[model samples]
Target: MTVLVVAAIAYLTLALILVYAIDNLVALFFPDAHSAMPLNFPTLEKMMAASRKYYRK
Candidate 1:
């Protein structure tokens, strides 16, 4: 049971990392495509901009 739980957690973590990597790659290579979408995940640049704005306040 414990081993199964550990495996599940690791799988989920890897999946999330993969998704984040793909999201960034798309944003990097296809900026116009990503911008045209109505709903999209925040990329690292967006997150960093938000963080900077927050810290400036």
Candidate 2:
């Protein structure tokens, strides 16, 4: 049980870090598209908006 709990915590930490990295990368690569969006993990809605804005260019 203890090991399981430790593994879950580690997995969540990694997931959060990965999301943050991806968010930053998106903002870096698509400044205009991401400028109006909040600085958080990319949800489906945000991704769609960014893609739409990018493709519109």
Candidate 3:
């Protein structure tokens, strides 16, 4: 039925919006929201390589 189709579409749209909002919120608050493993990130050397100095002054 037309009503069922419309309801399904609305449900899908709402679900997509919810997923996107949650993803953005976590990415904004958490430093590494996408990665699942530790030590997968860059080390201090890599940070220095990227010109990001962490001087302990």
Candidate 4:
């Protein structure tokens, strides 16, 4: 359990770093520069879209 917790934390940290690096790289290579938002993203819109698709009566 302890090992799993440590691994999850490390995994999350690495994933965030990789996302930043990739976002930077893409922006550097693309004509229109894209940047990560400096704030948290909410999943409610995505969740609602998915729910609507699957839950239509």
Best by TM-score: 2
- Candidate 1 lDDT, tens digit per residue, 1-57? 999999999999999999999999998987874444454466666878999999999
Tell me the tens digit of each residue's lDDT in model 4 across 1-57.
999999999999999999999999987888565455433356666768789999986
How many backbone collisions does model 4 have? 0
RMSD after Cα superposition, model 2: 12.1
| Tens-place lDDT digits, model 2, residues 1-57 | 999999999999999999999999998987874456566666767888999999999
lDDT of 3 by residue, 1-57 (tens): 999999999999999999999999988888675555455357655766666444643
lDDT of each model, Cα atoms only? 0.86, 0.89, 0.79, 0.83
Sort by TM-score, best first: what order? 2, 1, 3, 4
Task: List the candidates' TM-scores in order.
Answer: 0.55, 0.56, 0.54, 0.51
RMSD of each: 12.1, 12.1, 11.2, 10.9
Predicted structure 2, TM vs. truth: 0.56
Residue 49 miss distance in model 2 (angstroms): 28
- What's the true lDDT of residue 39 in model 1? 43
lDDT (Cα, 0-100) at 45 in candidate 4: 69
Compare candidates 2 and 3 on lDDT and give the better one: 2
lDDT of 4 at 3: 100
Angstrom error of the Cα, residue 4, model 1: value is 0.2
> Model 4 Cα displacement at 27 (Å)?
0.8
